[model samples]
Target: MTRTLVVVGHGMTGHRLAERLRALDTSGAWRIVVLAEEAHPAYDRIRLSSYLTGGSRQDLALAGRDFTEDPRVDLRLGCAVVSGDRAERTVRTADGEQLPYDALVLATGSEPFVPPVPGRDLANCFVYRTFDDLDAIRGAARRGRPCVVVGGGLLGLEAAHALRLLGMRPHVVESASHLMPTQLDAGAARVLHRSATGLGLRLHCGTAVASIEAGPDGAVRAVVLGDATVLESDLVVFAAGIRPRDELAAALGLERGERGGVLVDENCRTADEHIWAVGECAAVQGRCYGLVAPGYGMAETVAGRLAGRSPRPFDGTDTSTSLKLLGVHVATFGIIHPRGGPAAEAVFAEGTTRYAKVFLEPESGRLLGGILAGETGSRTALGPFVGHRPPADLEQLLLP
Candidate 1:
């Protein structure tokens, strides 16, 4: 008997789920089809900034030409899921074709969130999310126009650095008191602030764009702030935040979370038996994990279970993360701030052009999680210690 596996959204989780399902179900001859909304093949979105700076286009692809050109898997590019019929077990594409599936998986991913503000519809405004977005940025940068990145978080900082690389003065506007507020402690944010400012990218902490007004012909000329001041700029990019893509899932009558994610069990199964969801689109136990690692874990678990292989339940995700921002390496795992009294303590080390900090629980002194900025050669060896339930004493790794 032949089984048809249709994966909507050919991003990281969708491609992974399809490949793993086929590998696990060796007995079932299966046909796989992947529909991607973007015209490009699955690429490394995490490194999009690198491409924005100077990285080659060919380097961004996670999957080579072989995968897209392969005959076994039908890769449908530039296709969007307009609708889905759960009762009929079929998905309608933007085109006239309605594809039938014995089993379905949705991994539509997310979109960059730009809040409603005055003059937002003006020209020279953009969001940093897709390859097309980066290409537009590249075109703007070649003309050496001053760039303003609205939002001082990870992606925003990266965009600022990329703009600086293109020989344009880049400014960052963060509504928070410091940069990387959600990821780094106050002190760590200060260190990053100094580092970024020293590199010539202006930092406006504790403030944001009140409005974006156009000049003579509807081209962005200045970013107006609430403080009654305007920052001169010709280009603006928004890396503010992202919201999960679950509009299609919601129309299917499947249970969804308040944050607009399809509610799924540990095994990534929705209300229907033959249906599953994974990646950023899934809300497991009323929570949506925006990270890639947890999304891949969900894909692995669901694929295993569908193939009649027993797998461990999908536990709630950890908030641990490690990444580089504007050439600064940072990593954190466990809880940086513990709940009880004196449970969390921060230990830090300083070197030439580098900073590292670890937060540990008092009694356990285990690695609750920490951040490394500037260089991360050591965190590769240090991650296992934090990965192992914070260890017995958090002070040991920092001191010895």
Candidate 2:
């Protein structure tokens, strides 16, 4: 008998789950129903900044008409699941339509985290997230005007570069001591800092935003820092962080992670047997992953289970990240900073235009993690050797 699979969100991970299940269910064992909150179909959110720089919406789209028009798939755009009756195996949408499902998967994804600073709600303040958010920012952007971006991480830097493309002077404010603190060490951050300044972007590190000061018109006028410095600006973009969109979990009475996500087992299954979760909204084994790769892994795991295939258990996948920010290459793999007092030893190298460091297992030279900045061509070769000993010609691999 064919079963109905109801998916709550149609973001990247949710879309992947449906695609994977469709590929595995060649016998037509399951019919998929995807309800997306956004009016548009799933798009490539990783390249969202490209939308600001001459890339059309079509360029960032992940799902085409072919996928959406699949006979076995029911794709409903602008439909949001408001509540669910777990015992009844049914979900209610915002439009008052009820959906019955043999199984349900939640992929609600995440939202931009805006700090609780005063005047943040004033006009000209934005958060870098969806296509709509980018549209709003572009509408408000003024050429040659100062735009302050709160958060010095990957997304923050990306937003800054986008603002630069819009001809605005971008200033980055990072609460952490260095940029990309979660991924890069002090040495690597210095290299990134030089690159950023070289591109005419201003940096304000190691300080928090005291508050967003509004002008007489109630729009952004200046940003006050915790150190008592004031930066005059007309626009502010908050890319501080992201919080999982698990608000519906409360209505459904599902358990949540300590940090705020639907708590799931290694298989991405919640306490309810019929319900599963994937993407940034799920906390597998008490931890939540914010990267796209881990979310994809979760989607694959759940898809395999639904397809009746015995897939690999989802303990956790590699959290390594390799990306180019503002034309500067940065990559971090495995464990850049291990816990418990730096048990691993690191081999460091520096050059005129690059910086590289590799952490070894201290005894057998097993690769623990590494950081690359400026010239990151070696990331592709070094990433696979994580947790294993690398090639004997390690010295040559570090060369720029």
Candidate 3:
């Protein structure tokens, strides 16, 4: 009398779905099967760069050590679902195994976006996505060699740091006018730029890659900028961006987003009631969140519904980010930019030591958004104060 549930893509979000379902489904009404493309089970992709710093594979694992001990759960690593039949309620694997499911959930996550440039497929070039990719980069990296990293966002900075750890000269190339264009404003980026350069890392802002020039051996020799500036390099890494892996859902005629992602409702359900989507692959309310926190929230919502509990709709998520880049603290939360005209802004800076800015309502003194660079001791208290009015004596609390 038990129903079968097939969960596709065993990334962090899919693993979360399985773990939560088994925990809440006490009646054992549904048995779960997890299909993963990678040979390894779920590991934290957010901390992937930590692998370069002596962090082992097991250290990045998200699931428990005894994850597969449960009798109701089946974990199939390196098994990819090739096709799905909605009418038959079945899925076909790459090795010709057919799986029947009363319900199906897609957690395919995403893939890195490599820009179209000549010589991109050269031998010394790579993308920072998986454990294997890091292994390849480390194996190929020569000490004292010059390395070029495209993009200057979170992942790009992490890659540059990793290269520096490997004893390579790292140069970060950003097409945007400033670093972390989507996350930090000009002032915060300037502080980050200074900090990065202080670490012996070079910065090339507002410069787009025109092409990668390969030597006679077909390995990377140098990178040509859009403005015809050529910099010699032995390695190139593209940390441009990521796009959702919604092809499987798209094949089944499921609705998708304008850019790319499997469109889902508030409950993370697709057009077919039995089919659901979560993680970076899912477009909740017509937008896909690339962060693990939001994906974890969606997993909780889906697990509840499958357990016959009250459905909690995934309304939206905050784009808050808090992390250390090259040993420097960086955190940004809630509406870094204002929407309704100009708002009252406060600025605090002391040379290159630290910089902090807070935006408040001109009339009501309500906190709208803020950016903190160089020092973030106040982030622990200030992050929660977003969208609310702070106390009158808030200046003392934010002082470095």
Candidate 4:
């Protein structure tokens, strides 16, 4: 019997899995079927912010515009997998079609977490995640009016900058005291705040909107904060966070995290045999990796195993990351939070801007983790450190 693989999701992870499986397993026995919920093929969701600016929909293309010929891969577009039956090895789609497969992969990626604030349903209110999302924002910007973004993380800042490119000075509100609080250390966050402010983007930190007030006609006019302060707004885009689309998994009786992410083993396999999941939807070792690199790694590992090759198990990935904050560079890695006090040795700190602190076992001096900022040199040095590869002199790596 010929083995068939059905991948549910046309996102980045699903597309990569299809490409890798075909490349890794050259045997002509397996067939690939990819299901896309949207009419368009997979597009680069990472650059959705860029699409907010004046960019064509094709600019965010994840895969080619068309899929045709050769091994005869089947692509079901504009149809969503409503749920699945693991016992029968089948998935029910929105269009009432059942797809049967020997192996199933769930790449059901995340969606923009829309806050529950009032007036979020206004015509001017939106979420920036897909090409359609950007197109909507771009159309709104044609009115040449200011818009407010309700988060200060990477995507939110990028969205705000894209709005500036849309010819509007954007207001960015962060519930946290610092911007990019997860990715950057305090110092780096400060620098990013300065850069964002310098770029003329209004920064509102340590305050959150309690509700969005609207005109009598039911259009957004202002955002009312918890402190009873209200700021006028013509438009609002909420980039607060993302939640995994795991209802399908749960409906199928698959284990999932408290936050609704699919629970997968270190190798990206769920409790059910022959059912694998990856990408932001999978939470392994009690951590959900929202980064692309680890998702790509998980796809490769699963692909490797399907081909009868030895694939390595996945430990949780290091949360270290660096990125441009509205044009300013900021980076952080390792055990940033205060763990074992005085025992954790001070690794590096240069003039309050460049700093590195590590938490060692005190006896072993083994580099457990550390945080880096203000120094671009630390970017390359992070990979080996977080992976616990080898103890390279981080001080030497920092110095000229």
Q: Using TM-score as the measure, which candidate wins? A: 2
For residues 140-248, write the lDDT of model 1, one tens digit per residue. Answer: 6644566789999888998898888888898899888889887787766766877798889999888878999899988889998877778889889998877889887
After superposition, candidate 1 runs with Cα above 4 Å error: 69-71, 142-144, 335-343, 349-366, 374-377, 387-396
Q: What is the TM-score of each candidate against the true structure?
A: 0.90, 0.96, 0.94, 0.90
**Candidate 2 lDDT score at position 316:** 67
Where does model 4 exceed 4 Å of error?
65-72, 142-144, 333-361, 385-396
Q: Can you rank all candidates by lDDT, best first?
A: 2, 3, 1, 4
| The 10-residue segment with the lowest total lDDT in model 1 | 391-400
Best of the two (1, 2) by lDDT = 2
Off by over 4 Å in 2: 337-341
lDDT score at residue 384, model 3, on the 0-100 scale: 77
TM-score of 2: 0.96
Candidate 4 per-residue lDDT over residues 1-400, each given as its tens digit: 5688998888888888887887777776678889888787787777777666666777777666344344547887888999888889999999888989899999988888888887789878989877777777777774456678999888889889888877887888889888877666565576567667888899888888889888877878888877787788888999888888777777899888876788888998988878988888888754677777678888998888887788888655455556655666565555444344644555565554455556555665655666555554656665556535335666766433
Off by over 4 Å in 3: 337-345, 361-364
- In order, how many clashes per candidate? 5, 0, 0, 1
Q: Mind giving the per-residue lDDT tens digits that candidate 3 earns over 1-400?
A: 8999999998999999999999899999999999999999899988998897679999999877567777898889999988889999999999999899999999999999899999899998999999999999998898999989998988899999999988999989999998988778787888888889999999999998899999989899999998898989999999988899999875677889887899999999999999999999999978898778789889999999999998678756456678778666777666565766888988877666567788888898888777777874467788777778977666665654
Q: Write the per-residue lDDT of candidate 2 for residues 1-400, one digit (tens) a residue.
A: 9899999999999999999999999899999999999998899988999998779999988888878889999999999999999989999999899899999999999999999999899999999988889999999998999989999998999999999989999999999999988788778888889889999899999999999998999999999999999999989999999999998789799999999999999999999999999999999987888888889999999999999899998856457788888677888777766655564655555643677788877777788878888865567788788879877776577653
Model 2 score (lDDT): 0.89
**What's the lDDT for all of these models?**
0.78, 0.89, 0.87, 0.76
What is the Cα-based lDDT of residue 213 in candidate 4? 82
